[model samples]
Target: MSPSASFSDVVRDRRAVRSFLDKAVPDDVLRAVLDEAQLAPSNSNTQPWIVHIARGTARDRLSEALLRADDEERYSLDFPYDGSAYEGAYARRRQDQAKALLDALGVSRDDEAGRRLAARRNLEFFGAPQVALLCVPGFAGARITADAGMYAQTFLLSLAARGLGGVAQTTIGFYADTVREALGLPDDHKLLFSMSFGYPDKRWTAQTPRTYRASLEESVHFHE
Candidate 1:
């Protein structure tokens, strides 16, 4: 976000930028964003988030390994994620989000191959020049991991405020072993997700549709 952009502007400007340019983000900008995100509130200030930003050669190598692992179905998720758990309106929103994205890319619901190819791009980091691996201790448990979500959002917002963008992907978490090996992180440091970030590819950003959020009326409950 620019100097004139308000907090609201920054919030509204943020989106899951699927495609990014080949250009790498400068080191100073990366540091500045991390600094801002560090201020995010955490449970008891435990700050369980351990972020590893991979750039240049490391980023390239990790992306390659992820693609290979994905092909072999060498899944190694630290946590079980069942999207089927979302029911009613939640499920519909998830479906709508997928449809909107595919529609924007002109991939039909019946185009199984196309959909698969699109999904595979996640492993490629959508051509991003850098990716951040968000992790926590293997035994952090559900509550501590939940605090990491706050950290993740702050990181994402910081990116948007700087005219950068990223997509937080649980898909990358599926290849936890590959990521751990690439970073030489211990098995105890569990992978939660990743955000492939950099300057968004303007061609895709300008045309790709963004997902809608729920209205407060339906999403929140009034106590008063």
Candidate 2:
């Protein structure tokens, strides 16, 4: 495929998959995806992404560790979500997302039990056969985080091109210290995020919700 066509197709087809099949991804395919991911640009060519791909026993161990961490209140990392700062369009968008998700899962607004059950699925890596943890060196700044985002986008797009599906999850970062300890990562490294990857389970019609994006006119400006 031509670069433009390939890029557009991947962007259009990619979804945040929550259900995965038992099928395992080949090592060669995973390596190629990582290779493409590493092509992402970075500040001063620092290229500061550290990726760890876990499968089989390692994947099970990581998931077990994450579940244990989730059970402990001390493991929670608080993120600031300023509702006041998210007024009008942004706030409505967020509400719509929640409603859509709940509707898809047959969860009522007051169904706290159902919500918790759904949240637990995140800890299970949504039954994906492969899980990739992304990290950066201890001394890296915000620029490195941006580079990591670019790398992750590349990886997700590459997976989409290969008919694989996954979700990039920052929830893994909440238990970063725990994950670092569990995975035997160096103390200086920070867990940036995790992604669950594998062939998506095609039977789940509830996964069909389409996320939206702002129009170019709303998101861009023409200086010329």
Clashes of 1: 1
lDDT by residue (80-159, candidate 2, tens digit) is 22456887778888788778878888899899999878887888899998899898887777888889899999889888
Which candidate number maximizes TM-score?
Answer: 1
C-alpha displacement of 138 in model 2, angstroms? 0.8
Ten-residue region with minimum lDDT total, candidate 1: 1-10
Q: CA RMSD for every model?
A: 1.4, 2.7
The TM-score, computed over Cα atoms with residue i paired to residue i, of candidate 1 is 0.96
lDDT for model 2, on a 0 to 1 scale?
Answer: 0.82
**Residue 62 lDDT in candidate 1:** 92
